[model samples]
Target: MSELIGRLIQPRQPAFWFMVVLNALSMVLAWLAQKPELTLTVSLLIAAFALGNAALGAFFAWQLIRRPAK
Candidate 1:
């Protein structure tokens, strides 16, 4: 049971875990900004932020998944 718990909480890499946190925060920010009445400029800015977050998350995840040389 302890082993299982540890595995669940432990991240494979520290950088990946940090990215996960950042991604979560970005998602929350995007959610908060999701408003139909917002002006085009604000909406565009929010969209850009969201896209940048997603791209960074993807890149970090990719780097984590790719095995490095021995």
Candidate 2:
């Protein structure tokens, strides 16, 4: 788990960008799902996931940009 996170924090060119975009899109979808038939627990779960993904995306983006030019 530590290794996976360490890897995530390190840029991987196209793959890293793709992961960022994917997480962004997923977060958007989760945010959008907070409506209608879902119960409070379900909605909260979705929101939690959205927030988590958002944090992850921010972290990865920061790390990617923070990386020194190669």
Q: Model 1, which residues run further than 4 Å from truth?
A: 1-12, 68-70
Off by over 4 Å in 2: 1-15
Candidate 2 TM-score, true structure as reference:
0.60
Q: Residue 61 CA error for candidate 2 (Å)?
A: 0.6
Which pairs in model 2 have colliding backbones? none
Worst 10 contiguous positions by lDDT, candidate 1: 1-10
Model 2 lDDT, residue 4, Cα: 46
Q: What total of clashing residue pairs does each candidate reach?
A: 0, 0
Instruction: Say which candidate scores most in TM-score.
Output: 1
For model 1, the local distance difference test gives 0.68
Error of 1 at 54 (Å): 0.7
> Estimated TM-score per prediction?
0.65, 0.60
Query: Could you give me the TM-score of model 1 versus the true structure?
Result: 0.65
